[model samples]
Target: MELNNEVIINNLVKRFDEIVAVNEVSLEVPAGSIFGLLGPNGAGKSTTLRLLCTLLRPDSGTASVAGHDILEEPVNVRECTGVLPEEGSHTLYPSLTSYENLEYFAKLYDVPEEEAKKRIEDLLKFMDLWERRNDPAGELSTGNRQRLALCRALLHNPSVLLLDEPTSSLDPIAAKRVRELILKLAKQYGQTFFINSHNLAEVQRLCDYIAIIDEGKILLSGRTDELRRRLQSKQVFKLRVADNIETAKSIAEGLDFIFDVSIESDSLMLTILDPVSNNSVLIRKLLNANIAIIELAEEEMTLEDLYLQVIKEEEQ
Candidate 1:
């Protein structure tokens, strides 16, 4: 494993009775990158996280975290990694005040009293929970409690963070706030985050690298931008015409570089083989045919589009 990789798994497998939860999974998360593990429910996303966090030993396979072997150095692996499981509040004490809950965990992590105080105050303020610092964690809203759980994970300042649905239950506003905080922390601390999420949009916004898993297997994994380009085999464009819609469609379809064309009201949507060089030629040909060009633009492929395409292909 390279030094720049914070986590590496090789053919990691986990089984419960006769069913396999995680089978032959392998991937490497680069240091300081926010990597997303995306899948539908019961797709082994959470199980993979548990195995990496050393909470559940893999039935077979080897992995490492921050240079410590998971099987040989479970203690060091746990110490170097922080986890916010699906039930974030389970790590908190409902009866204990937010401040007290964090303070208690800080002591367990052996963070010095002076440093813990400073770290606690800074984290509370950063998460915008300073005012609720003295209130019992159970009294805070769902979003606030999630923030508090995040603070607890960061109290010890571990090198890697394993977050399972960090913003699962929050409203849009609260979810956006959590996303901003994750970006800010990744930028400021260079922390490597391994996140398992069902929200494709959230993962698209916050993660630079992504992997799609299903049926205890990895379908694909790569840099987000690269995946978008490579997975979308065709480029789609929208071209609006002032007149002669039928004529414009005919011209576009006749072009060798154009693969597909669809007419919509006064516009033509063309799927071209080479959008970068063929667009200008397409417009020139249409204008020459006496079709007035109103507008031309390329459509970007979204994560949702990619996800659906990959999943549908796998099913077929």
Candidate 2:
């Protein structure tokens, strides 16, 4: 049977006094897909997540998770969805040990006793918290606590997962592991994920599709590569030459398509007007000018680039 869209929002809005925290936001997250909500701080990413998870009721709109209406069937929605809020660590009992926390949630989630025991042990070992399993949750390091919180979120294996800043306090290695685990779950278990994150690189790497939200409004949403291709024409390229870097800069500045030429330590930073058509033109001009080119490459277009451009356009 075809699964319904794991999460859906329509004309979703929320407010806190004079501040409109979420303004008529709408989105659809397909089942078994990794969907990322990307935005700057205070841009309503967390608010949207909170609303979907039934923590906060929408002021003027509706949302659903796992085919259950967040407003009308909040209990059903919560039963089918797992959540890791922005302050995920705080959701754990301060006095409960890491294993105890997961054990407690496992009972609430109704995982069979034997299964919960084995699942808890495996998760602790996978997160490298086995040694600290007996330590009180309040005593664990911030990174360890974050891992523990993630473990609790995954304990019941719900159909939909809503994670806000899942790796916020984690170190580089821990963060990477968390990202890897997300992919693993989505692929092996076919779980749908709706994530809120400001980590652009992480989103770029993990998200199958993404939406950029700002000031409680969505700017754009699409596949990651397609979004990057939108700004391909305005790509930036760096040129390095074995000799006569200034002369190369002059050759580039003479072209109408080239602008903002900066000479940096034997290299030149160029803002190419239409890189698809003009990149080779600049290379030809430099080679013809007797500038022994060391390397000429277009800078990788990142989610940061698309995000900044979208945010800037929205601001204007």
Candidate 2 residue-wise lDDT, 254-294, digit = tens:
99998789988988998787787888888888888888999
Q: In model 1, where is the ten-residue run with the lowest total lDDT?
A: 300-309
Question: Can you give the TM-score per candidate against the true fold?
Answer: 0.80, 0.87
lDDT of each: 0.88, 0.87
Residue 28 displacement (Å), model 1: 0.7
* 1-316 per-residue lDDT for model 1 (tens digits): 6548999999999999987999999999999999999887888999999999999999999999999999999999989898999988777999999999999999999999999999999999999999999999989998899999999999998999999999888999988998999999999999999999977778878999999888799989999888767755557788898888988888888888886689878788887766667778887887788888889987765545566667766798
Worst 10 residues of 2 by lDDT: 300-309
> Which sections of candidate 1 miss by over 4 Å?
1-3, 232-304, 311-316
> Which runs in model 2 stand beyond 4 Å of their true positions?
1-3, 110-112, 125-132, 138-141, 241-246, 259-266, 273-277, 292-294, 297-304, 311-316
